[model samples]
Target: MISDSMAEVLRLLQLDDGFDAAAEVAVRAAETLGVDGLTVSLATGGEQAELVWCTDEAAGQFEDLQFTLGEGPGPDAVRAGAMVLVPDLAQVRAGRWPALTTESGALAVCAVFCFPMAIGAIRVGVLTVVRRTVGPLTDAQIGDAQVLAHALTGRALGATVLDQDKAPLLHAVVHQATGMVSVQLDLPLPQALLRLRAHAYSSGRPLLDISRDVVARRLRLDLNGNGDGNPLPVSDKD
Candidate 1:
């Protein structure tokens, strides 16, 4: 059953050639999966991110509560590079995100699923869905969600965010470069992103191009940041 839904995602990806069209498909897919609301956020830069697309006005409220209150499952999923599932938000309000969890549960959104949106090696955002019933996702649904998550990740890599210095969001070069640094420093993914960003700034290079160099292994990350970055000519197109 869910395989058919995943196939539908691929087919929808083929038909909808742009972000807006893709958003529509995502919302429809959620409906087919029995979710009430959905929000798809594409990572922006810095300590925070931006919400790119969302289904239903309720989803906007859900996102806003997190932004305004400064904590929630959505942000956690992005930062941790993992899915954040709230099978039932109603009773689990003593810790944090009180308003959000309570309101969502009150609205009969009992189960919430979040899937990380990742590029080849970088995590950028999460695909979030809210369900009226409180229960874990079945294996088929989880598999279908994974497929949609990948689709969303690919779309985010090509997205545009005015905040990222007016550059394309989740640039491929950055992801490649981050992977390269991750291996070199033996650091976690988020930490590696910081390293790549810092190196690019010190070298006075666009983060994307430099990241490409790092990912291609043409430019190696020096564990010691003291050395002056001598820009090396990287022939490979990453």
Candidate 2:
């Protein structure tokens, strides 16, 4: 039965014409695995990432907390380039993602399973599943999640190619914003992205929203530690 369901997910992903189809796979995976919610997050640059899809509001909340706080199983999984399954979030060791544990506890999330989304050496992102009940995924559920993660990876990577000129299968606008920051701040691309992530987290805004502002010429980040609508003169070094 699980195999049949996994196969169906793959089929639907192949037929998907947009991100909606990839989202459906996450929803179906949550149903199949008996989890409460799931989310797919793709790394844009450096430690920066964007949520591609999620199964529900709960899933979005979980992903947002992680993105805001900058630590969680999702980032850990992507960094490790492997799975990070916390069957009991409350039981985790001290200082091991304390922010995630405390915040997620309030949401009634008891278990979280994360799978890295990668092809070869390139890590695209992570698929994180959440549960309210305290228990590990059964072997069969893990297998099903692996299959679903595979399909999601293809969908995410393909979405980039299908949208415009072929780019690395990640968020283009965010990348463009990162480049803008890099030039504006006279900093390396990776450092610029880290600064962007820090600003988004500190201000409690979605990284995508902040990136959009940068891309649209509505916001400019200054090396003097200001992020405002008024544009600064382009750095002489730029």
Candidate 3:
């Protein structure tokens, strides 16, 4: 018997001929799961994951936070190629994702469930669902999410090839800024990205905002110590 949620997913797949069919289905799945919102990210070359779509601001913010901190259920699901369901972020050990735990508290996010879109050993992407309330998903909700994840894997494979240009690459600016930081500091891309994260976290600013400043040349990061002993100094370009 086709579950109501799965039935809706199939109906959307068949009827929605829009460019972002996968996103539409994902949003419906989020509704069925009773989550506040969700985001979909496709793994790019190497360790990068591009944010392709998000249902709401909170979802997008959480995704960006994970991207900046390099921790959280989304990243863990991608790395482990398995689902990482967090009933309550408060219950998570401090060491599990120390920075993410501390930072995410500021957002209206208390629960996150990450479903990795994978087939066999090949990982396609991840679907991250977030909620304002704290609790595990009901068994039926979990099943519906699994159905969505499986469907997304196939959809993502085709979308990655055909809709590559149309899909929003939200993190493209971050990568561009990372490269600029790498050149400015004479550091590798990884280290440059770390510096960007550190500066953002220390300033209590969004990572994307910091990256935008770097790309615009409005903010120059120097080795001079800020009052907080942070080596990255935020200064306007002369």
Candidate 4:
């Protein structure tokens, strides 16, 4: 039986019936779950999940950081096919998410909860909730979030089949930049992507910014570890 909170969220989702319904539901779900904000990301393939919708800037930043670093409650929940409830980021042990932990210290986030949207063997994506106040979710909130996650899985699948192009591709440029980097460095795609991520982490910049620079031909990574560990700025002139 769907709880009142879950029912309300589902009703909001039904009102849209378009590709953008996911965004509406995300905002409603965050309110229902009593969190500060939330984000929904759907798995594209091979450990890559693209952010489709987020309730606020903090939630979006948290999700983007996870994608850039490839480690965090969202990825862990997706990998394990279970929920990762971190009531307080400060309580987490060091090295759990080393780069994320260090980088996110300045953010206003204090708690994070991740729920995997999956059905048996098929995994769809993740629903991540964030709160500025450090505390575990209420039992009711957890139950409603799980229900919303399941509903979102079906919505995501339908969106893929109905209007795949209309679905937001927040990280499309990043993937294109990765491919370009791979060819430039004569490295495999995975290695090239890692180099981009490494530079983003070390330079304390968003992955999207670094990728934009690469795709725009304003930055080029080399094989001498300069691009990986210390990226050099390139002039816009050819």
Candidate 4 residue lDDT tens string, 76-162: 998888999999999899889999999888888999999998643346889999999999998888988887787776565443222
User: For model 3, how many clashes?
Assistant: 0
State the RMSD for candidate 3. Answer: 15.2
lDDT of 4 at 152: 75
User: Which parts of model 4 have CA positions greater than 4 angstroms off?
Assistant: 159-238
Candidate 2 has which clashing residue pairs, if any?
none
lDDT of 2 by residue, 56-151 (tens): 787778888987888988888888878999998888998999888788766867888999886444567788898888899999989888767766
Q: Provide the overall lDDT of each model, using Cα atoms, as 2-decimal numbers.
A: 0.66, 0.74, 0.76, 0.78
Q: Looking at candidate 1, what is the lDDT of residue 97?
A: 73
Task: Evaluate residue 219 in candidate 2 and report its C-alpha lDDT on the 0 to 100 scale.
Answer: 78
TM-score of 1: 0.64
Q: Which stretches of candidate 3 lie over 4 Å from their true place?
A: 17-24, 159-238
The best candidate in terms of lDDT: 4
Off by over 4 Å in 2: 159-238
- Count steric clashes of candidate 1: 0
